[model samples]
Target: YPAAPQRFSCFGFDDVNAALAAMRFIHASTPPTELYLRVYQLESRQLPRRSELRPPVRSSPCDCGFVGNQDDEDENFLAIARAMEEIVDDRVDCYWLIRCFVNQFKHKFGDSIPHL
Candidate 1:
């Protein structure tokens, strides 16, 4: 949360490129190369480990007929999830669902998480 562009919002901000841009901007640095390194480490952990960033390194068969990397269960899950979470009407949105999920479990998480 270092030098984040402050915001006051009750409306949805997730799934918007604007929010991503703001984040990228906040962590931006010109000639200060150190920022990029920190940013990479932060972002790597932000989603998943570096290994998970790429597809499975190797796939081998075992006793279960087929055993391999199932899939990247990180953002990929939420990508499909958000699309499917859309309702037929305006009663609920992906944003609300994500907010609800974070609210429900954020407390259980450690202090690393700032807010929902």
Candidate 2:
């Protein structure tokens, strides 16, 4: 069967800052309990370079263990993997999980996102 048609409203702005401002205004006026913002770039431009005169450094031949132990990092990653496995085992929809994560991220970092 053909996919169901999707309808969405699109707004254009001269720059990202303008778009973000519009979004903030809309969000404040009609504050939805749940909302997700997805921004897409219509055009791309090469950024101007400031300075470039550094040569690549070569690695030493001797084996040196400069890096510290990563057991804690590894355990943390393993714990996350286990939790994800459990969620999958519960048959949670992947799209729902992604949407939940995106909403959480927006709630946590929405204000700071424009800086990034």
What TM-score against the true fold does each predicted structure earn? Answer: 0.27, 0.23
Question: TM-score: which candidate is best?
Answer: 1
Q: Compared with the true structure, what per-residue lDDT tens digits does model 1 show for residues 1-116?
A: 63242232223232232343455532333211222222323433553343444322222222112112224222322333334355422212443454455345444642433321
Q: Give the least accurate 10-residue stretch of model 1, judged by summed lDDT.
A: 59-68
Candidate 2, residue 20: lDDT: 39
Report model 1's TM-score to 2 decimal places: 0.27
Per-residue alpha-carbon lDDT of candidate 2 for residues 24-115, written as tens digits (9 for 90 to 100): 42233421111112121112221112253121122332322222223322222233333444555321232234345545644796565435
Alpha-carbon error at 73 in model 2, in Å?
30
Candidate 1 Cα outliers beyond 4 Å, as residue runs? 1-16, 22-80, 88-93, 102-116
True-structure Cα RMSD, model 2: 16.9
Q: After superposition, how far is residue 107 of candidate 2 from its true place, in Å?
A: 0.4
Task: Score each candidate by Cα lDDT.
Answer: 0.33, 0.30
